[model samples]
Target: MTSITATSAAATASTAGKVASPYNNLNETDFLKLLTTQLANQDPTNPVDNTQMLAQLAQFSTLSAQNQTNTNLTTISDQISKLTGVPIKVG
Candidate 1:
């Protein structure tokens, strides 16, 4: 039983480390699946409020959009810096 539990845990961790998307790893489909699972498993007596859920979803959408925007800005900045012979430091 102990060995089985260890193997299961290791398998779970290994699967989680696998990249599902080559670009934008945390995409909409993954986000929606997680949200659905949370909703399905929530406590019935004190369930998550509709307003809070919508707000959370909106926040996720905003974060994803911001990440895309940041990526685009970084790419453009890098291109401009290259043209201007300026070194851009990214951390």
Candidate 2:
């Protein structure tokens, strides 16, 4: 029947782009994308543990905050160098 064929087609379409395995290659830059993909591909009947994912997210947030602080410090240091003409170098 057309209805049966349509149901099967819909089911296949839904799973066409999905992988049955989880991804392990994660880095800071593509981390969010990888996380989302992992979540989307996970088996709903046996979902992955959320504790590790939450920790990773928190760590990434902390890293971002630290990076911002470092940039601000560098900018302030440059301004001070210009004012004092001391050729200050910050790393």
Candidate 3:
């Protein structure tokens, strides 16, 4: 468990390119680091709410999916443009 200050410091460092991160983006490593810190520091007397934790996990999953989808779409769009000689935008 990390103190809030430690977590904040880590995030700040990450944003400053201290971590092997991807273009100042929040990636899986950051998520897992935060999650691990949270689980380590949670009070046993009042543990993290299961529902909230689940929701957070779900959100992370969805975000990963969306990022991958967007990357794939971009690649497809590029391929299509190359094949058709016309650029097409994809989301």
Task: Give the candidate number with the greatest lDDT.
Answer: 3
All models: lDDT? 0.85, 0.83, 0.89
If the candidates were sorted by their lDDT against the true structure, best first, what order would they fall in? Answer: 3, 1, 2
Q: Arrange candidates, best TM-score first.
A: 3, 2, 1
- Per residue, candidate 3 scores C-alpha lDDT tens digits across 29-76 of 888898999999999999999999899999999989998999999999
TM-score-best of 2 and 3: 3
Report the number of backbone clashes for model 1. 0
Candidate 2: segments with Cα more than 4 A from true spot: 1-29
Clashing pairs in 3: none
Q: Give the alpha carbon lDDT tens digit for every residue of 1-91 in model 1.
A: 3456888998888997685755557678888898899989999999989998899889998998998988988898899899999977644
- Higher-ranked by TM-score: 1 or 3: 3
Q: Could you tell me which 10 consecutive residues in candidate 2 have the lowest summed lDDT?
A: 19-28
- How many clashing residue pairs are found in candidate 3? 0
- Tell me how many residue pairs clash in candidate 2: 0
Candidate 1 Cα outliers beyond 4 Å, as residue runs: 1-29, 43-46, 88-91
